[model samples]
Each structure stands twice: as structure tokens, then as C-alpha cells.
Target: MAELIGPRLYSCCNCRNHVSFHDDIISKAFQGKNGRAFLFSHAMNVVTGPKEDRTLLTGLHTVADVYCGDCREVLGWKYERAYEPSQKYKEGKFILEKSKIVKENW
Candidate 1:
């Protein structure tokens, strides 16, 4: 019998809690506060903080900080609203800092 495999995942670097799947990534070319980031269509095992408007490299956007549910570590942010039409695609998506996450089940 063939051995089964699990989905590749991204985990919180601080706690190793599963946060996202590799297949859910939308873009890898993103910038975060520390360094590189990734855009993901969905994230799990996370908590969103209060929403606030912030000016980013893209533009002004309503975003909420996302934390690791297990450890409460600040992982990144979720795009609640985008002011610019071109940036609207990011709405409801998640940005996870590369420095804050680790690969799992690879």
C-alpha cells in the first residue's frame, strides 16, 4: 500500500501551530514589516484583532492584526477593506510574515 501524505502547512514560528496550507498561497512576492511575506487565500488557527485603517505600501486599508490562536503571537494581518480598486483583490485575504512562520509536513 502507498503511504498517505498530509497537506504541506505553514505553522507559527513561535508555537508551531498550523496556520495555513501551502496550496492556499496566492502570492509569495509580498513585503511585511520585518521582511518577506506571503498572501494566502485562507488561514486557520488564527485570531484577528480589532480592525483599523492603516497606510501601507499598497495604500490605505482597513486591516486587523492576526495572531496565532495557540500562542497569541503576532503573525501578520488580514485585509478587511481596500480603498483602492486595484488593491481590492486583497480584501478578505491574509498576509503572513515569512519570519513569523515555519514550514511543516513538507
Candidate 2:
């Protein structure tokens, strides 16, 4: 039988970009049209592109594409600014595409 793991870490599939640590995960397996993704309250070694207004999602005042720090591959997006203050917590958070990431042990 497969042992049950508490949780899994994720990295960019193409270049194995380590974005967040275990404690940084806000949510896992977020489903979308693209695919399942991991939501992190914090991420590291990510660069954001120019912020576009009212483009990606409604009420998302400013959003930008996030890239891997090493390979420059599109990994996820960073929400810089949002219309609601309550949503401001997600300003620096990331929604990394599962399809672009690989689950890692430890």
C-alpha cells in the first residue's frame, strides 16, 4: 500500500523552480479551466511582468504573469492589486499551474 503523505511540495516541471515551501501553501489542487494548481500565500524567486488592469479576472485591478527565476518559464501569476481590501491578502500570492509543476517529496 502507498503510504499517505501529509502534503507534497511543488516545483516547476520544466526547470524545477522552487517557488514556495511547505508552510507557504495556502491551498492545494485548485481547479480551473487550465487544470489543477497550487495556491500559495507566498512564493520565492518569481518575477512579475507588467501589471494589467481589469484584464485577467473581474475585480482584479492589477495582475501580472509570474515567471521562473532561473528558466524564465511562465509558472503562474501574481496579484499585485485587487479592488477589495479583503482580497489584498492575495497581492503577493501565486496560483501556480499544476500542469507546469511537479509534486515533490519532502
Candidate 3:
């Protein structure tokens, strides 16, 4: 099995917009309606979203599409609101595509 790890830095491949996240914050790999894949993160930075685009996603409330601050590339999204009590934990978190982000060391 893969051993549990700690925090690591990641960045946008197109513009180098970066964010740091603990391995624990990563939720799961999700496939969007547009057929795009994303890696969910409970914490992120150097992003600009959760303000411009909004839409209803699954059981969640209005989710915002996030972008890279430097290149305006659609990096991921933030779960702005949650409609269900169980989903409330996902609010304020981010969802970035693994393809869009590259590990600083790897």
C-alpha cells in the first residue's frame, strides 16, 4: 500500500499558479459533466474562482468554476455551498485536475 504522506506544493502547468495542500485534504478523483477529470482539494491558493461562474452540481449547492490567476486557465472549482448537511464539509474546498497541476518535485 502507498504510505500516507504530508503536505506538498502543486502548480498550474499552463501558468504556474500554485497551491499547497496536505495529502489528507485530497478527497477523490471526479469526472465532470464535460468529461474532464479533477482532483478535489480541501485547501488551495493562487486561484480566482468562487466569484465568476456558478452552477448547481449534483447534491451540492452553487459551485464555482475556478481558474488560474496567471493564465486564466480553468484549474478547478470550489464548492461554494452545500445543500445537504452531510455535504457541508465540502464547502470552501477546491477541485483541480491532476492534468492541470504538476507536483513541484515530481
Q: Which candidate is the best by TM-score?
A: 1
After aligning candidate 3 to the native by TM-score, how far in Å is the CA of 32 from where it should be?
3.7
Q: 1-106, model 3: which lDDT tens digit per residue?
A: 9876544767787866565454634555565545444545554555555454344455646677777777777766777777788877777777776677777644
> Whose lDDT is higher: candidate 1's or candidate 3's?
1
Clashing pairs in 3: none
The number of clashing residue pairs in model 2 is 0
Off by over 4 Å in 3: 1-7, 22-24, 33-45, 50-57
TM-score for candidate 1, residues paired by index:
0.97
Give the TM-scores of the predictions, in the order they appear.
0.97, 0.74, 0.67
Q: Compose the digit string of candidate 1's lDDT tens values, residues 1-106.
A: 9778899999999999999999999999999999999999999999999999999999999999999999999999999999999999999999999999999988
Q: On residues 1-106, what C-alpha lDDT tens digit does candidate 2 reach at each position?
A: 9888665567777888677677777877564337777778887877888888754444555878888888988887877787887667767778888787776777
> Which candidate model has the greater lDDT, 1 or 2?
1
